[model samples]
Target: MRGTIHVLNGPNLNLLGEREPAIYGHDTLADVEAMCRAEADAAGYALEFRQTNAEHEMVDWIQAARKDAAGIVINPAAFSYAAYPVLDALKLCDCPIVEVHISNIHRREAEWRSKSIMTQVVTGIVSGLGVHGYALAVRHIAEVRGRTK
Candidate 1:
């Protein structure tokens, strides 16, 4: 069986740690990707780590994951709240999706942030743990995939 999880990021995430150190922590996106690769390997799964600022690219990747991966852990970043195209593509695939946010959206400003649009579609959501949230989500993806097999 094909066993792999896709860790997809969207919009401005490439700047992760430096984006806002106080909010996102000091680990760059590359750092998080490396951590995820190790976590997936330890859990006995392969991973597809990708990031794109373009909405269409993200949608295309989500569509592609239908055939390429067993699960998806996506941190849509600035796209989470309003990118309908990306959300639609994600919903079309069977891969379990776990939405992640480094900073808790609920505790943030009144207008700058909002709840995830994919909340109902996601198997789980991990927020407020900074980069650690992605590690948790990846582990969950592996465990969930393991059982379904």
Candidate 2:
């Protein structure tokens, strides 16, 4: 099987290094992309790393991944709460999907923060590990892909 991993980010993740450094850490989205690239490359998998603030774009990417990607690692950001479209699109994907969060949403102040609509469709989740979570998510998909091969 072809090994192509799609790493998708949503919403304010573009402001990573500058947006709430205390909670999300100081790594920029570029930094996270680089980490995911390295991990994917090390495992001999091609990577498609992307981020968007728009929910429609995220849904489009997830839809594309259903046919073109071997696995996916997504950080749905604010959309994790109630973006049923994204979740519905994710349901179409047969490949493994891993959800990542730069911070532990479970420990956040708001109860809504702990709930992720994506949780039902993803293969697994990586949370609270800072930027390294992206790398770990990629690594997991790589491992799963390897096993299938």
Candidate 3:
């Protein structure tokens, strides 16, 4: 059976496009969702795309995905630095996890911003790739599952 891929976004990502055009590019979250949906459809996987500003909510979704999803693509946003609970929840996922960052966190001015706790638990990461990162993550999950099948 084909499985669902959960795409989770955190914190200020809902304000994409208008928040910082220079760093995040001009694509809105809706645009990113459309792109991801199209990619998931092409791969014959159901997409469960979600964004939240609350840390607890993000963690809850991650826990939910553990039961229902075949894989996960998450952009933890500011939570990448200190969301230990989020990282812990992600550890429960048995399927592949791909972490995404729209901007190159390594190139950011703040040293703390360059770190991602999620990297420890994820299968791979897509950074500095703009909105296209979501599609890449979805495609990767699809490809990996395809090979397994």
Candidate 4:
């Protein structure tokens, strides 16, 4: 099998470093993308980096991953707690899936943070570690790859 991964981001995350620096930290989205690409490469994996502010686009990408990739890492951002469409697409894929969040949703205000509709479909979730969550999720993906070895 090809050890490929698709990193998908959604809704306003393009403003990473500057968007609420207290919550999202100082790493820009491009900065994090570079980190993810390098980390995936180090883990012997190929990557497909994608980002969109539209929920439908993210859903479409996840649906496409069903036949096109080996693993998936998504930072659905505000959509995580509200995106049933994204969850629906994830449920269609058999590949290993991980969700990423730059902030700890559960610790935030009830209205500002909410439960993930897609959590049940993911093998694991990484959040609140800021940009490092991406690389850490990559390691977890590598570990899953390790087990199947």
Using Cα atoms with residue i matched to residue i, what is each candidate's TM-score against the true structure? 0.94, 0.97, 0.97, 0.92
Report the alpha-carbon TM-score of model 3 versus the true structure. Answer: 0.97
- Give the Cα-based TM-score of candidate 2 against the true structure: 0.97
In candidate 4, what are the lDDT values of residues 1-149, reduced to their tens digit?
34788899988988888888987888898998899888888888898888899998898888878875768999988788878988889888887899998887778878546588778899899978878998888777877876886
Worst 10 residues of 3 by lDDT: 62-71
Encode model 1's per-residue lDDT on 81-122: one tens digit a residue. Answer: 899998889888787889999998889886557667878688
Residue 122, candidate 1: Cα error in Å is 1.1
Per-residue lDDT tens digits of candidate 2, residues 1-149? 25689999999999999999999988899999999989888899889999999999999999988976889999999999999999999999989999999889999999999999999999999999999999999998898888988
Superposed Cα deviation of residue 133, candidate 2 (Å): 0.7
Ranking by lDDT: 3, 2, 1, 4
Instruction: Determine which window of 10 residues in candidate 4 has minimal summed lDDT.
Output: 105-114
- Clash list (residue pairs), candidate 1: none
Model 3 over residues 60-91: C-alpha lDDT tens digits? 99998897687999999989989999999999
Clash pairs (backbone) in predicted model 3: none
